[model samples]
Target chain A: MLAESLALSALLFTIGVVGVLTRRNAIILFMCVELMLNAVNLSFVALSKVHGVGGQVFVIFVMTVAAAEAAVGLAIIIAIFRHRQSVNLEDINLLKG
Target chain B: MTFDLLNPVQLSSALLPDLLLVAGAILLMLMAAWRPDSDARQRTVGFASIGLLVLTMGLVVWMAVSGLTASDKGVIAVDGFRWMVDLVVLLGAIGTIALAIEHNVRDGIVQAESHVLVLFATSGMMILAGARDLMVVFLGIEIMSVAVYVLAGLNRRSARSAEASLKYFLLGAFATGFLLYGIALVYGATGQTQIVEIGNAIRRFDLTNDPMLLVGIGLMLIGMGFKVAAAPFHMWAPDVYDGSPTPISAFMAATVKAAAFATFMRIWYEAFYNMFSGWAPSVWWLAVVTMVVGNVVALSQKNIKRMLAYSSIVHSGYLLVAVTAASALASTAFTFYVVAYTLATFGAFAVVASMQQLGETDARISDYEGLWHVRPWLATAMAVYLLALLGFPVFGGVGFFAKWYLIQAALAAPAGLTILAVILVLTSVISAGYYLQVVRVMFMKPRPEGAPEPLPVGSLTRAVLAVTVVLILGLGLFPSRLVEMTQMNAFPRYPFSPALQMGQPQFRR
Candidate 1:
C-alpha cells in the first residue's frame, strides 16, 4: 500500500512540475504549486504507516503552509492583474534585466 | 534520547526573544489595523517596531552572555551558534526597519505593517537558525517567506513592485514545493525528521546506497540552493532583489542568506555527515558555476541594485565554498564571513537609500559619478564598503581576513578542496572588476550635466553607514577576536569534520 501510494504521489508531483513549467498564466502556476504540495502531503500520509505520528504531524504543517501560500499568492496575482490587465507571465517582463 | 519534551517553562525561556518578537508583532499589527492611517501614528508604530527589535537583540545578547543552551521541545537547539545568528538577524531587522519607515514616509505609504512584518520575519529567522527538526525547519521557512512575500508588494502603488512581488511569490512557492517533497522523501527513507535521530538511522541501516535517500538529499539541496540563490537555481534573485524596497533587499541579501546557510550547514553537518561522498562534489560544481555566472553577469549591469544583486550571488558562492568544506573551522569562518558581508552589504544599501528621490531608487551606476564632489563623506563611506566587497588588500581588512579564513578552512578538509579555494580566489579577483568600476564612477568619473541634487541623508542612515565603515575596518584588522568567538560557538565539532570522512573509513586505500 505504501509503495503504491508513493508511486501515485510521485506521478502527481511530476504532473504538477510539468504544469508549472508549461503554464504561462499566474493563476495556473500557483495552482500547479499547490498540486505539488498536496502530492507531498499524500506521500507523508502513506509513509506515516511506518514512520508513526511524525509523518502525520508534518503533513498537517505542510497543509497549513500550503493554505497560507495560496492566500498570499492569490493576492499577489490580483495585484499584478490590476497593473498589467493580465496575469500572464509573458506580460510581467517589466523587471527583466 | 536526549531530546527534551513537554517542558513549557523551559521552552519559553529558551524562546525568550521569539516571545518578545511575537508579542511586539501582534501589538504593532493591532495598532496598525485599528488606528487611523496618519503620519504621526505611522511614525509611532515604526519607532515602536524598531524598539521591539532592539529589545529582542538585547535579550539574545543576554542569553548568549548568560549561557542559555536549553533545547526543549525536541525541535530547538539554542546554542552559541544560533544565538550569534539571532543577533545578526536582529541587527539586520533593525537596520531594515529604519530604512522601511524612512522610505515609507517619503513615499506616503503607512509603514506600520512593514514594521510588523519585519518583526515576524526576524522571529522566523531565529527559529530557522535554531531548528533541530526538519518539520520545524519547514515551518520556520514558511513563516519568514510568507511575510517577505507581502513585504515585497507593500509598494502596491508601483506596478513594478507588484510584478516583483507576484514573480517572487510564484517562484518562491515553487521552491517551497521542492523543499516539501524533499522532506517527505527523507522521512520516507529514514522514518525520522529529527536531525540526530536521522543520523543514527543512517548509520544503523548503512543507508548510503539507498537510492531514495540519495534522491531525497539531492532534492533538499536543490531546495536550499534556491533559497540562498545559488547558481542554476538563482533565476529569481535579481528580479526579487531589484524590485523589492532597497532596505528589504539589504535585509534579504544579508540576514536571509545567513539564516539559510546556517540551516543548510546544520542539516548536512549534523544529519548527513557520513554521506559527504555523495553530496560534496555537487556542491563543488555549484560553487564554480555560481561564482562564474554571478561575477561575469554583474559586469554588464547598469543598475547599481542589479549589480549588487549579482555581487551578492557571487558572495553566496564564496559562502557555499565554506559549506562545502564542512569543517568546524569552516563553520566558524562562515559565521565571521557572514558578519562582515552583512555589515558591508547593509552599509552599501544604506548609501543607495540616500539616493532615493520621491520613493523610487535612482540606482544607475552613472548616478554615482560626481558623488564624491557633492557628498564626500557618503562617497568615502561607500568606497570603504566597496573595497571590502572587492576583497582588496590593506583596505579590506575584514574581507581579506574573511577570505583567508575561508581558504584555511578549505585547506583543512582532508579531501582536496584546494581547487575550490583556488577558484574562490580567482573569482574574488574577477569580482573586483565590477566592484572597482563602481568605485571608479563614484570617485573618478565626472558627474554629467542635469545630474540630480544629492538627496538628504537621514541621521539614522548616516549612523548605519558610520558603524559599517568602522566595523569593516575593525573586523579586518582584529579578526582574531571574532574568529576566536566562532571557534567557541562552532557546531558538529571534530567527530563529523570533513577531514574525518566518517563514511568512507578508507580514504587512501
Candidate 2:
C-alpha cells in the first residue's frame, strides 16, 4: 500500500512536469505545479502513517509552506496579468530566446 | 517550552547572523511603510539594509573567532565550511546594494521593499548554509525564493519583469514540491530527517541499493538543480535574468547561487556522502551539459542581459563541477570557488547595471562599442571581471585557481573524473566566445554615432568596482592562503569518510 501511494505520487509529479513543458496558458501551468504539491502532500501523509508521527509533522510543515507559496504565486500571477493583459506563456517573451 | 529545570536557548548561536537579518528586514519594512510617499524613506531603507548587512558581517566575524573554542551544536554545524560561504554571500549583498542605489534613486519603486527583500534573502542564504535538518533547509529555500520572486517583479513598469516573477515563482514552487517529496521518501526510509540521523540510519541498515532512496536523492538533486539553474533544469534563467532589474539580477546571480551551493555541499557532504559513487557520475555529466548549453546558447545572444543570463548558467556548471567533487579539499575548494565566482560575477553585473539608462534600456554587445574610450576605468573593471570569468592568466584571476581546484578534486575520485576536467576546459574556452565578444565591442569597435554616453556613474558603484577588482587580483595572485582559509573553515573531512557510511541506511530509505 505504501508503494502504491508513492507510485501514485510519482505519477502525479510526472504529470506536473508534462504540464509545465507543454501548457501555454501561464495560469494553467501554475495550477499544474499546485497539483504537484498536492501529490507531495499525499505521499507525505501516507509515509507518516507508515513511519510514525514524524512524517505527519513534516506534512504539516509542507502544507504551511505550500500555503505561503500559493499566496506569493497568485500575487505574482495577478501582477503579471495586470501588466500584460494576457497569460499566454509564449506571448510574454520580451526577454527573447 | 517543555524544558527541565534549566531552560536552554532555542535559538542556536549559529543563527545569530540570521536573527539580525530578520530583525533588520522587519525594521526596514516598517520604516518603508512609515513614509511611503517620501524619497527619504527609500534612502533610509537602502542605507539601513547596508548597515544591517555590515552588522551581520561583524557578527559572522565574531562567530568565526568564537567557533575556535566552541564544539559543534546538535544538527547545526558551523565549521569552516559555513563561514566561507557566509563571507561570500555577505560580500555579494554589499556589492548588490551599492549597485542598487542608483537604480532605486531613478525609479520610484519602493526602495525599502527591495532592501527588505534582500535582507530576507540574505538571512535565508545564511540559514541555508547552516541548515542541519531538512526542514530548516526547506524553510531557508522558501524565505529566499519568496523575496527573490518579488525582487524579480520590482520593476512594475515592465511586463517582462512581472512575467519573469510569475514564471520564477511557479517553477520554484514546483521544484520545492519535488524537494519536499524527496525529503519525505528519505525520512520514510530512514525514519529520520536530521542529516546525521539519516546517515546513521543508512549505515545501520546497509540500504545502499534501496530503490526508494535512489528516487529520493534523484528528486532532491532535481530540486537543487533548479535553484542553481543547472542545465536541463535551467530553461527559466535567461528570461528571468533579462527581465528582472539589473541590480536584482546581480543579487540573484551572486548571493543566491553562493547560498544554494553552500547548502548543496552540506547536504551532499554530510548527509549523502555514502551515495557519492551513485550521484557524482550523474552530476559529472550534468555539469558538462550545463557548461556546454549555457555557453553555446549565450554565444548567439545579441542582448547583453540575455548573454549574461546564459553566462550565469555556465557558471553554475562550473560550480557543479566543484560540487561533483564535494569530497575534495574538505569542501573548502567549493567555498573558495564560490567566493571567487561571486566577486567576479557580481562585479560584472554591477558594470551591467551602470550601462542601463533610466527604465529598461537594452544593452546589446554593440551598445558597449567604444566603451573603453568613453569610460576607460569602467571598461577596465569589466575586462578584469571577464578575464576572471574566463580564468585568464594576465589578471592572475582566482577563477583559474577555483577551476583548477574543482578539476583536481574531481580527478581525486577513483573514477576518471578527468573527463570532467577536459570538459571544463573545453566549455571554458567555448565561454570565451561570448565573454570576449563584450570586450571586443567595448575596446576595439567604435562607439555608435549619436548614442548618448551613459550617465556619470555613482560614487557607490565606482567604490564597489574598485574593491571587486582588488579582490579578484588578490585572489588570483595569492590563492593559497584563501584556499587554506576555506580548508580551515570546511568540515575536517575530504572525500567521504568511513563514518559517513554509518548514516547511509537512514538516507537510503
Candidate 3:
C-alpha cells in the first residue's frame, strides 16, 4: 500500500511538472503549480503512516501556504490581465532582456 | 542558558526579534488600512516601518550580546549566526523603506500597504534566519516570497511590474513545490523534520547512502538553487528585477537574497555536514556555472537594471563558492560578503532610483555616459559602488575584503577548493569587464550635448548613499574590525558538539 501510494504521488507530481512546462496560459500555469503542491501533500500524508504525525502536520502547513500563494498568485494574474486583455504567458513579454 | 522551546517563556525569548517584528508589522498594517491611501500615508507608513526595523535590530543585538543559545531540539536557533544575519536583514529593510518612501512618490505608488508588506517580508526573513527545522524553513520562505511577490507588483500602473510579479509568483511557487517534496522525502528517509535530528539519524542509522535521502537532498538543492538565483535555475531573476520598481528590485536583490542564503547555509552546514562528500561537487559546479553565466551575460546588457540583475546573479555565484567551502570560516566569510554586497547593492540602486525622471522607467547604460559632467557627486558615488561590486581593491572598499575572505575560505576548506578558487578569480576579472564599462562611461565618456541634468538626490536617499559610502570606505580601510566580528559569529564548526550545544560561548572576545 505504501509503495503504491508513493508511486501515485510521484506520478501526479510528474504530471503537474509537465503541465507547468507545456501550458502557456497564466492561470493554467498557476493551477499546475497548485497541482504540484497537492501532489507533495499527498506524499506527506502517505509517508506519515510510517513516520508518525510529523508528515501529516507538514501537510497542513503546505495546504495553508498553498492557499496563501493562490491568493497572491490570482491577484497578480488579475493585475496583469487588467493591462493586457489576455492571460497568455507569451503575451506577457514587456520585461524581456 | 539553553532555551527549551517547549517552555512558552523560553520559546518567546528565543523568538523575541521575530515576534516583535511580526507584531509591529500587524499594527502597521492596521495603520496603513486606517488611512485613505495617499503619498503622505505611504511616507508615514514607510518611516514607521523603518523605525520598527531599527527597534527589532536593537533587540537582535541585545540577544547576541547577551549570548543566548537554544537546545539542539529547539526549532529556532539563538546564536551569533542568526543575530548577525538578522542585523543584515534589518539594515537592508531599513534602507529599502527609506528609498521606497521617495521612489514610490515618483512612481505614483500611493499604497501605504506597500511599506507594511516590506515589514511582513522582513519578519519572514527574520524567521528564516533562525529556522532550525524544515517546517520552519518552509514557512519562512513562503512568508518572505509571498510578501515580495505582492511588493513586486505594487506599481499597479505599470504592466511590467505586473508581469514581474506573475513570473516571480509562478516560478517561486513551482520552486516551493520542489522544496516541499524534498522535505517530505527527507522526512520519510530519516523520519525527522528537525535538521539536527536528521543529522543524528543519518549517523545513528548509517543512512548516508540511502537513495531516498540522496534524492531528497538533490531536489532541495534544485529548489534552493532557484531561490538564490544560481544558474540554469535562474531564468526568472533578470526579468523580475528589471520590471519591479527600483527600490523593490533593491530589496529583492539584497535582503531577500541574504535571508535565503542564510537559511541555505544553515540547513546544509547543520543537517548535512555528515554527508559532505555527496553534495560538495554539485555545489562546486553550481558555483562555477553561476559565475560564468552571470558575468558573461551582464557584459552584453544595454539596460542598467538588467545588467545589475545579472551582476547580482554573479554575486550569488560567489556566495555559492563559500557554500561549497562549507567551513566555519566559510559562514563568517558568507556573513561578511553579504554585508558588503547588501551595502553596495542598495547604494547602486539608490543611484539608479535618483537618476530616473518622473514617470520614466528606461535606464540605459548610455544614459550614464558623461554623468560625471553634470552630477559629479552622484557619478563619483556610483563609481565607488560599481568598483565595490567589481571587487576592486581599496576604492571598492569593503567589497575588496568581502572577496578576500571568500577566497580565503574557499582555499582553506576541507575539500581544498583550489580550482574553484582560481575560477572565482578568473570570474572576478571577467566581471570587471561590465563594472568598469559603466565607470568608464561616467568618467571617460563626454556628456551628451542635449542631455538634461539629473534630478537632485532626495534627502533620505542622500543619507542612505552617504552612510553606505562611508561604511564601505571606512570598513575597507579598517576591515579587521569587521573580520573580527564575523569570526566571533561564525557558524559553529561542530554544530552537534555537546559543549557548544550547551549554550557556552563558542568564540573568544
lDDT of 3 at B471: 94
| CA-based DockQ, model 2 | 0.69
Q: Which candidate tops TM-score?
A: 3
The docking category that best describes candidate 3 is high
Q: What lDDT is reached at residue B115 by model 1?
A: 79
lDDT of 2 by residue, B23-67 (tens): 878978888777654556666778888988999999888878665
Query: Candidate 2 — which residues are off by over 4 angstroms?
Result: B1-10, B68-73, B493-509
Residue ranges of candidate 3 with Cα displaced over 4 Å: B493-509
> What are the per-residue Cα lDDT tens digits for candidate 2 across A36-76?
87888778878877777877777787778778877887888
**Poorest 10 consecutive residues by lDDT, candidate 1 chain B:** B500-509
> What TM-score does candidate 3 get on C-alpha atoms?
0.97
Tell me the deviation in Å of residue B315 in model 1: 1.0
lDDT of 2 at A3: 84
Clash totals for all candidate models:
2, 15, 0
Ranking by DockQ: 3, 1, 2
Candidate 1 residue A43 C-alpha distance from true site, Å = 0.4
- Higher-ranked by lDDT: 1 or 2: 1
- Listed for each candidate, the true contacts retained, as a fraction, are 0.89, 0.66, 0.91
Cα misplacement distance, residue B150 of candidate 3 (Å): 0.5
Model 3 residue B254 distance off true place after TM-score fit, in angstroms: 0.5
